[model samples]
Structures are given as C-alpha cells and as structure tokens.
Target: MADRDLRDCFLNTLHGKAVDKVPVLSVTQTGTVELMKKSGAAWPEAHFDAEKMADLALSAHTIAGLEAVRYPFCLTVLSEALGCRVNPGR
Candidate 1:
C-alpha cells in the first residue's frame, strides 16, 4: 500500500499536480555531545543514535522554519565504509 501510494504520488507530480508538504533531511557534525548533555541524555553514544540525532536535527527546521534534518555525523564513516584503515582517536 505504501509503495502504491508513493507511485501514485510520483505519477501525479509528473502530471503536474501538487503533493503534500516537502520532507527534508539534513546532516550535522559536532555539537551533538553538547546538545545531548544539555538535554540530559546520558551514555556517550546517545549522540550517535538515530532517534536522538533526528530530534536534534529537527530543531533547525522547527526553530528556523527551514525544511531539514541531520544525518552522517561521523566524518569517519565514509573512510571506514570504504575499508580504509582508521585508528580510532588518531
């Protein structure tokens, strides 16, 4: 049902019809620890979790009325995912 709905929505747009609100995703690095600390979220990696990260990212859109969210806070993920050797804390 979701797939069909999405297809219909896309088709309608191709035919020049309006859809619902635009969804946006934004990514951020740094400041997570500070934000988490202020929000009283313990655990060092709570800054790395999706839900918490999304909550923090959504604040930009909420406060500034800009459509955006946060993603890929780790600068190392690209290197790591590509199988490069990364010594942590280097």
Candidate 2:
C-alpha cells in the first residue's frame, strides 16, 4: 500500500472496516519531552492553542513515526472548564 493510504487504513480500521493493512496507530497522546523539543511544541501553551496542539499532534506522525495524530495533549480541558483546578504538571 502507498504511504498515503495509511491514513485511510487507520480510519477504516478504527471504524471496523476492511483495509489492505492495519496501520500502526497510537490512539492516546504520543507526545514526549523529546517530541516536544524536536517539534518545538511544548505543553501549557500547546494545551491551549489549537494550532500548536495540532502541530504537536501531527509531530507524532512526522517525528515519532506514528501512523496517526491524536489531540488535546492532556485530559484537563473539560475539568478546568468545569471549575476544577487542573494542574498540568511538567
């Protein structure tokens, strides 16, 4: 399969549809301190900025060789919005 087909493979597999091959994907946040530094996308700010978040998410694929990109680096947005003090620890 072509490299570009990986995206469809990932999506099709996610929806339980058939594909030429199963794409290796991380459904969870694949970011690391290494990836953050390499991609120039750190936390705190990336957690709030949509563009930064998307860039960081895409870095998983571009930098870490992951087949897919995930979003919302941390799980604190909803909690924070709900008035909970979300300490996004470094």
Candidate 3:
C-alpha cells in the first residue's frame, strides 16, 4: 500500500470507521468527594448561587484536565429555578 493510503487506513481504524482493531473507550464522570480532596478544591459554600458554583467547577477542569465541563454541578439547580430553597447539604 502507498504511504498516503496506509495513513488514511490508520486514521479510519482509529476512528472506528474501519473495524480492524477493537476501539478503546474513553469515558468519565464527576461527583466524587475524594477527587476534590486530592485536588485540594473547596466545595462551594452555596450551591444556590450560580457564579460561585461555576467557579468551583472551572477549578476542577483547570487543575486536573477534565474531559468535559457542564453547568449546575449541584442537584439543586432545578429546584432553585423552581423557586424552591436549596439546603446544599454541605
């Protein structure tokens, strides 16, 4: 095979477009107190406040190279929006 053809084939295999090799899965999730402790990140004082919560989340990705970052780390996000009080259970 030509070098160009081989390179394309390799790329396809890596992306699972071709079925030559079994693909390695890369997936992860958050929400572990131990992880925060290891990284020395402080939990938010008030999960009800959007800005403070965002800061706490950004610190995780910035410090540990997280794969993905999404909003409302606290479960109270929906409750807060619905005008319900969030205790945060800190």
Candidate 4:
C-alpha cells in the first residue's frame, strides 16, 4: 500500500486505521541545536513568534526527516496565559 500523506498518516494511526508505516513524530518540541543551524529556524525567537514556531516545527519534517510536525516549542505559553510569571530564558 502507498504511504498516506503525513497528516493523514498521523490521524489514521490515531483512529486505528491501517497505515503502511507509522509516522515518526516528535509531538512536542523537536528542535535541536543542529536542526536550528541547518534549517535557520532556531529557538528563543521561534518559541514566541508563530511564524518562526511553524517554520521550526516544519523543519522537523523537512530537515530532520521526521514524518510529521508538532508545535509550541515550550510549555511556558500555558503558564504565562494562566497568569503565572514566565522567565522565557535567554
């Protein structure tokens, strides 16, 4: 069977559909120092900027050869939104 699209592969797997292969996904922060330099989608800024975050997440698939992408580089966003002080370390 042919491989499904990346999104479909992920969804199908969740729904217990038969897929040719399960997608290798990070499901969280997938960035690495190496991936940052290679894809030019580094951290710090990417964590805050939606565009940069998307770019960095996509790099997991495009550059790191992962089958899927996930977003929000860190958990600080939730804490910040809940009025918890966030440091956003440099």
lDDT of 4 at 59: 86
Candidate 4 Cα errors over 4 Å, as ranges? 1-4
lDDT of 1 by residue, 35-72 (tens): 54654432334445766666555544444333434454
Q: Indicate the TM-score of model 2.
A: 0.71
Q: State each model's C-alpha RMSD to the native.
A: 7.0, 2.6, 8.6, 2.6
Task: Count backbone overlaps in model 3.
Answer: 0
27: Cα error in model 4, Å:
2.0
Poorest lDDT segment (10 consecutive residues) of candidate 1: 22-31
Which residue pairs in candidate 3 have backbone atoms (N, alpha carbon, C) closer than 3 angstroms, thus clashing?
none
TM-score of each: 0.40, 0.71, 0.44, 0.78
Clash numbers, per candidate: 3, 0, 0, 0
Candidate 1 Cα misplacement greater than 4 A, ranges: 1-47, 85-90
Predicted candidate 1: what Cα RMSD to the true structure? 7.0
Tens-digit lDDT string for candidate 2 (2-84): 55787778778989998776677676667788888988888877887887888789898888778877787666767987999
Compare the candidates by TM-score and give the number of the best one.
4
What are the per-residue Cα lDDT tens digits for candidate 3 across 10-76?
A: 5777676964433222233343465456544446642445565565565455544443354556556
